[model samples]
Target: MTTERQFQHDSQGPLRRIVSSVFSIFETRLELIGIELSEEKERLIGVLFLGLAAMMLTMMALITLTVLIAIAFWGTYRWQSLAAITAVYVLVAIVCALRARAGLSNAPNVFESTLAEFKKDRDTFN
Candidate 1:
């Protein structure tokens, strides 16, 4: 009976250790994910603010330039000037849309480090 109890205890010790180690790895991975998420959130917010400011400034400049052109050519080329401005604006919009689409398509994968860590762990286990 004593030997049997000893054997059970010895088996449980390693099993417990393995469970504990697994939990530790999980905790570490979760913490890493949290950190990456927080960083991404901060970066996104910063980009949002900067992008808003840039858009506002660009809109103001475009409006001012259009008004100036219309006023300067009001005597003879008023309609032509406006039409040309409209065409330019349309071209700019299409180009910007295409560029933005391309940029998004080429963006790096999010949580790259976390994925890499997971792959490393899997490879090590295998």
Candidate 2:
């Protein structure tokens, strides 16, 4: 009876350790995700504010320049100048769209670290 009890206790010890280790791993991964989320949020807000400011300044400058160009041409070449400006704007828009698409494609996946940690755990178990 004593030998059976000792064997049971020994089995329980490893089981307890396994459970504890699993919980510890989960807690650590959760903490890392929380930290990454906070950082991403802050970065997004900062980028939004900066983008707004840049857009406002660019619009103001474009308007001012357009008016200046129109006044400079007055009667002659006025239509041509406006057409050229429109063409340039269209080209710039296309380039910006393509670049934005490329940037999105190249961006790293979110939760990459978590996935890596899980992979490590799987490998260890295997």
Candidate 3:
């Protein structure tokens, strides 16, 4: 009996075609998703820059207004006025600090959980 070679001549074999089609679809979807994410990142970065600029401008205006008010009121009080303002500023800062502490305590701690989940997924897939 002569050995015969039977080549796989059908390029559209069911499983291979199906796998190729699925892979192409997945590739297309991933590409589209990447493009969307890149666009979103660009938009978010632009917004961050604009917000930073606005915050800086507002802070500058506020500082100028505060200086003007301070100068206007400077003649009414003695040197003790500066000390009193400093004390008030300190008190306000303490209250803000306390508020920030409370906020931090209430906020979700996601870093460790996120890292763990990321590692788990990486190991499971790869």
Candidate 4:
């Protein structure tokens, strides 16, 4: 009876340790995931503000330049200048769309590090 009890205790001890270790590893991964999410959020917010600012400034400059160009050619090549500006804008729009598509395709996957860590853990366990 004592030997059976001792064997049971020994068995429970290693099993408990294994469970605890697994949980600890999972907890660590969860914390890393949280940190990655936070960093991603901050990055996106910063990008949003910066992008908005740049877009606003660019629009203001374009508007001012367009008005100036139109006014200068008002009595001469008014229609021609307008057409030229429209053509330029169309071409720019096309280029910007292409570049944006390329950028999206090339951008790194979000939560890359977390996914990598999970893969490493899986490999380690395996």
Highest lDDT model number: 1
Candidate 1 weakest ten by summed lDDT: 117-126
How close is every model to the real structure, measured as TM-score? 0.97, 0.90, 0.54, 0.93
Superposing all C-alpha atoms, what RMSD in Å does each candidate have to the true structure? 0.8, 1.5, 7.2, 1.2
lDDT of 4: 0.93
- Among all windows of 10 consecutive residues in model 4, the one with the lowest summed lDDT is 109-118
True-vs-predicted CA distance for residue 25, candidate 2, Å:
0.6
Cα-based lDDT at residue 40, candidate 1? 93
User: 29 in model 4: Cα distance from truth in Å?
Assistant: 0.6
Clashes, model 1: 0
lDDT of 2 by residue, 1-126 (tens): 999999999999999999999999989989989988888889889999998999899989998998999899878999999999889889988998999899989988788988898899889989
> Across residues 1-126, which tens digit of lDDT does each residue of candidate 3 receive?
223222344544776987886677557656656666677679769988997998799779756765766786788864565566667768977997999799779965434444454566558558
lDDT preference between candidates 1 and 4, better one: 1
Candidate 3: regions farther than 4 A off = 1-12, 77-126
Question: Residue 63 error for model 4, in Å?
Answer: 0.6
Q: Which model is ahead, 3 or 4, in terms of lDDT?
A: 4
The pairs that clash in candidate 3 are none
TM-score for candidate 4, please give it: 0.93
Candidate 1: lDDT of 30?
A: 92
* lDDT at position 40, candidate 3: 67
Clashing pairs in 2: none
